[model samples]
Target: MTAPGRIGIDMVPFTRVRALLGGGLLAGRMLSADERRLLLDGDEPDVPGIAGRLAAKEAVFKLFHATGETVPWQGIEILRAESGAPWVRLSGRAAALARGAGIGSVSVSITHDEPCAVAVALTAPDSEERSAP
Candidate 1:
């Protein structure tokens, strides 16, 4: 049987992230390789994008936490589809935890305006095979 969906939301300020990015290494530490590439390839002043992704990651983390799971910062990767839609991919401890929790997939939505960014994540059950009656 499918369980009720769980949602998590997070918001962050670009100014805070911009200050953290000033350290240079913080971005590499927080973002995956592909995410870094995308950020670099984008237009200048990527603070909003960075903040949005950070919020996305936080939202996913909160979702897992709500389900009594603790995933590492790098264990959850947020990537954009070719169409520019945000999505979540889990790996390492995060993936193992999700599997144990019966979480099949997660959907993410991200939005940003000058000073702030926000993200929402929704968790759903994996589709299960049914037997013929």
Candidate 2:
């Protein structure tokens, strides 16, 4: 059974994402079919700046078995620290749920390759090691 202090991790391959979102890319400045073509022809795939963040949110939901309620998208945002360490941005209802769940901290890792992006999330219980006799 899932516990209050349980931690979960999930991974998504870049190729899969590319296949899914490739067609969605239209001719545009931000991202377009031409860009997709270039990506397909080139060695590296170019994922949008926001793709990683979006995937991270989904990954967080998966890890927690939460439907964006306890940890809504608005609550969890991906950010890059000065050291280039990616982290989450918690706020609003999402932050409240995390606190109530006794979550001391949460960590996320995100990577992007072309069309698809992968993300990992880790949640730690507020307290570890119950009081022992």
Candidate 3:
């Protein structure tokens, strides 16, 4: 039987979401001093990759069920598998939350068509996990 644990699901029709993130990245420099403080307060990567990574980032937050506003979006990175799956690599508070939840692994799947991309994520504990008494 499947064990009980936190589960979260989020999807943005690849087309629209990609555009939102891509645009946000491009305008990073153009962002108002206030806007910059919100999304790009810390180090960030090249603009084009922002869309895919941001999608994965949101997914991780959902799995951890945390809304750490202090956590920078850059803390979550999306690593690709040979089969083209995107995996979550969390850092900072996000990583801490995953560890606290006893999650030993995370699984993610991403799909793209034309100018859009979509992803689904699952977080699970290692076999070492034991149900509470």
Question: What clash count does candidate 3 reach?
Answer: 0
Candidate 3's C-alpha runs over 4 A off are: 1-3, 13-50, 67-71, 114-116, 128-133
- Whole-model Cα lDDT of every candidate shown, in order: 0.74, 0.54, 0.53
What's the lDDT for residue 37 in model 3?
Answer: 48
From the highest lDDT down, the ranking of the candidates is: 1, 2, 3
- lDDT by residue for model 2 (1-133), tens: 1235455454445554455556653222222233245333455554443466556766666554555454365556566566666666565666666566556556778777665577777774545321211
What stretches of model 2 exceed 4 Å from their correct place? 1-47, 67-71, 125-133
Q: Highest lDDT: which candidate? A: 1
Q: Tell me the tens digit of each residue's lDDT in model 3 across 10-127.
A: 4445455446556665344222333334335457633333444555556666776555454345555565545555555666666677776666656666554445445566766576
Give the alpha carbon lDDT tens digit for every residue of 69-103 in model 1. 54466777787776778777787887776566566
For model 1, give the RMSD to the true fold. 5.4
TM-score of 2: 0.55
Judged by whole-model lDDT over C-alpha atoms, candidate 3 comes out at 0.53
Clashes per model (N, Cα, C within 3 A) = 0, 2, 0
Give the better candidate number (1 or 3) by lDDT: 1
- Top candidate on TM-score is 1
Among all windows of 10 consecutive residues in model 3, the one with the lowest summed lDDT is 26-35
